[model samples]
Target: MTRTIARLALAAAGLALLPGLAQAQKNAPHNDIAAQAEQVFRSSFRADNPKYWMTRLDQDEAMRLCSQYRDNPPPKMRAQIEKAQMATIRYPVEGKLIGDWKEGEKLAAVGTGGHIGFIQPDPPGRLRGGNCYACHQLAKKEVAYGTIGPSLQHFGKLRGNSDEIIKYTYDKIYNSNAFSACTNMPRFGLHSWLTPEQISHIVAFLVDPESPVNKD
Candidate 1:
């Protein structure tokens, strides 16, 4: 038991050390590279912009953890991180998790919010989108969708409308990290990338028989 415990500790230590060793072998100072990158990145932005936007370049706890593990944290740590993330999800207040799929279709198609050219964000009233097409193929009709995520065409046909499945899909879109510790999926809901109503509508698009997603 003692030997096994020692071996596990050494393995964990080695995993932690690996990235640093690689960084050092390049004869580069860690903070210097990071600071230089940040300087270059910030220089691209206008100084008149909101300070909060600049703050986003800094890492939060979750971002730091994922970076430390290279997005492959150990099983135990991953579960802990996921549990913490799951707690962040806020369900709808009106108990309405489904909305009009027509609205959702529009939301899914809207891709103008993030990191766009010269213009800064309009005040809070600006419409945001799921931008699902950027990483997911939603329907056969949309010939220009991305392939980063699994094809969601015929999603309803394959996965029936059950409370459990609906809830899982909702939560997955809300905070994908809850389902996949190192998922490439963005934390849409957790990051306010989408609202509950918006998410519900997207869910409707995925599950509604009359939605184009199902027809395609």
Candidate 2:
């Protein structure tokens, strides 16, 4: 009840500032407003929403640096971030850098799991897939793929699944920030969003000669 009242008051105060927002903002201390904004944000979430001790709201070193630079840090800082992120990557135990593309294809298409909110809580044992197609085009058949990232059709045909390419593909999938700091691509393995074996499977889906990503 108190948090709800505070949020409402904050909203009202914000509206009251609209008439002379320019002058008021000029006079307002940024730190004060920032603190108030943070309170409002915190108050907006339901108590249960932040439960389960999830670290989703917490920022790690890389996330902090990325946010500090607005995702475009200096070249030197970018290199530092990438190197640090690279050190966090772990390979599979059996020395396998590629796995079944069929599994990878399923993972790429699945965008389910890790859901939040009281009405949207994920069910037990629900698979948390990488949902690669959400950001990049893999097979020519999935006409609904997003364009946030470059299309990867014919990836193996163009790059050829060489030993170096296999390693590169695995490393990139495990932790894309190792190659490019602040990249939109998630650090699947580093964050444990996907297992090392899962990443290897994704690598195969992109580099296997017979995979639809190449054949199609």
Instruction: List the global CA lDDT of all models.
Output: 0.79, 0.84
Go through the candidates in order and give the clash count of each: 0, 0
Candidate 2: where are CA atoms >4 Å away? 1-43, 48-54
Steric clash pairs (candidate 2): none
What TM-score does prediction 2 earn?
0.80
| Per-residue alpha-carbon lDDT of candidate 2 for residues 1-216, written as tens digits (9 for 90 to 100) | 999999999999778645543443354445475667757866776676556544576678778667656688667667777887899889899989999999999999988887776676788778999999999999888899998989999999999999999999999888999999998998899888899999888889999999999997
TM-score of each: 0.74, 0.80
Candidate 1 segments whose C-alpha is farther than 4 A from its true place: 1-49, 116-126
**Which RMSD values do the candidates have, in order?**
7.6, 12.6
| lDDT at residue 178 of model 1 (Cα atoms) | 86
